[model samples]
Target: MNFVHNITAIFIFAPFLAFIILLFLSRKKLKRGAIGFSADITTFLLFLSVPVSVEALWGVNISFAVSVTAILMAMILLVLEWKKTKEIEILKYVRKTWRLYFLLLAAGYVIIWLTGLALTVISF
Candidate 1:
């Protein structure tokens, strides 16, 4: 029983741990691009955890709507920012951290899938 509790606790707190790390990095004033991208990813993970959490607690399968919505909102904001900045160098920010972005993207999807699987398993 304690092991089960521990696993659930880890699942619930993983995103929060990442969030705390992000906060610490922010205090150190790291590059905005890196922090911003990480924040987006952390947010996506946090959102992803919700439906899984619900399923874990209430035996109801739910879609990862939150993650999709967050992605859409991010796209909208990016477009808006590009319009506001009106700079052709918009892609430069992405280029600076392309590898990091790719890694984060992969990690985000992995987290979503893993969490969903864990939730389904635990719910039974």
Candidate 2:
């Protein structure tokens, strides 16, 4: 159970790790489009993990409904990012505004985390 909890913690914090990596890369002079695309992939993966965590820790007290909501939003964002990646203007804009990408990702992560934590505690 401790192992499972550790794994869940890792899954939960993975987005923050990705955000830090993206931030560091951007600071190191990576291309904007590349950074934006990377951030998109990272964020999508982060959202995808929510469902997996819920399922794997089924008996654990976590906000399953919130995880579902995050997954839905994640899918939508993934599609939008995919489409944006195909358009020159949008891709350029995304690349140039990579920091905004990080900020959005951070915001999403915090919201989902807090919502799940709150709901889980309340369930008990």
- C-alpha TM-scores of all predictions: 0.40, 0.41
The 10 consecutive residues of candidate 1 with the worst lDDT sum are 93-102
Error of 1 at 60 (Å): 3.8
Q: Which runs in model 2 stand beyond 4 Å of their true positions?
A: 1-13, 31-38, 56-109
- Which residue pairs in candidate 1 collide? none
CA lDDT of each candidate? 0.59, 0.59
lDDT of 2 at 6: 85
Q: 1-124 in candidate 2: lDDT tens per residue?
A: 9999786576455655755666677755666555565566565555555545555545443456655654676566657766877654655454434444445556755665677778889999
Error of 1 at 25 (Å): 9.9
